[model samples]
Target: MNGIIGKKVGMTSIFDDAGRNVACTVVEAGPCVVTQVKTDDTDQYNSLQLAYGDKKEKSSTKQLVGHFSAAGTGPKSDVVEFRDMNLTKALGETVTVDEVFTEGDKIAAVGTSKGKGFQGVVKRHNFRGVNDATHGQHNRQRAPGSIGAASYPARVFKGMRMAGRDGGGRVTVKNLRVLKVFPERNLILVKGAIPGPKGGTVILHK
Candidate 1:
């Protein structure tokens, strides 16, 4: 498959071959179960749907439980599809990290960024606020200034970059180099940081 589901296991620094201390984010990649296969004739596209993480049987719906039953596995928590992933595995076959990725290979990581709820333009949009703290600029230092004109187009623009909500959005970080892969431990280390908080789910795609 072209991708695998993983959990962010946090970050660490490892010494590379050049003896440089390389920082990397640890990801607990899956030995994911192939739950379903889509074909061009059947679904009008070719893709593989995989399931990851364990879910309590009682917590799952009967339909999902029966779906897992067909795959010969218990209820799963996460289900994701990777398009154009060429695979001919059966419904219950497993795919591990080592099979798809190798060290030094550049890949992409996708995840939801950590949420920084309602924020201002300074922090959210990186707007330099006023640039000076002179006179009576108390709480107005970080305020977004001059949003709209006075009369003509009096309304604020539709796609204004003003702050409302920040982060907790799906982010894709590409060109991250794979530093290490431990298939036995179901873990892979990638250069630099990935999105989301600790234990958050991520997808590593080639």
Candidate 2:
């Protein structure tokens, strides 16, 4: 369950050894600092608290400043805990992208999907409203018709699909193949698209 915090660096295509075009999402992972090492005796559980990216000193809280300072590092923009990390590392240690993952490894990326604010059922829930334009149906093509029954259940069902806010939620994309690893650049190329828009933060779990 080793993992690291990263930023989605957009997508690109590369040719494999077989000359097959492979679509991959580029991620700038790590050089994460181990801010804290929690043990069962001290914290009632075992986990590694890692911090990555950079933040302005003025923008960071006093508590956060003290926390990273304890690790001999500056303010970090993202922090995450990995409970199942097998390797033992001391606080203030650095973890890189290539140190945990390699080419051909299968990984899972967790991120927030792009927000589609106030969407309709047609796009949100994939509702095919009023297939036919006839029967005097004018602008009801994308409408969610008849939310509830008239007599039996006077109100709409609790889980009924309707138009509302969409996306901008935590999403996990599993089994993404690790196409390549650039240790020097701290970049990892993973096959297939990952959640979130460009520059969004993502956690790569191996």
Find the candidate with the highest lDDT and give its number.
2
Q: Tens digit of lDDT per residue, candidate 1, span 142-168?
A: 889888988878798888889799999
Steric collisions counted per model: 0, 0
lDDT of 2 by residue, 1-206 (tens): 88999999999999999999989999999989999999999999899999998999999999999999999999999999999688789999999988789899999999999999999999999998898898899999998888888888788789999989999999999999999999899999999999999999999998
Candidate 1 C-alpha RMSD relative to the actual structure: 1.6
- Worst 10-residue lDDT window for candidate 2 reads 148-157
TM-score for predicted model 1 compared with the true structure: 0.93
Best by TM-score: 2
Global lDDT for candidate 1?
0.92
The C-alpha local distance difference test score for the whole of candidate 2 amounts to 0.94
Clashing pairs in 2: none
lDDT of 2 at 170: 99
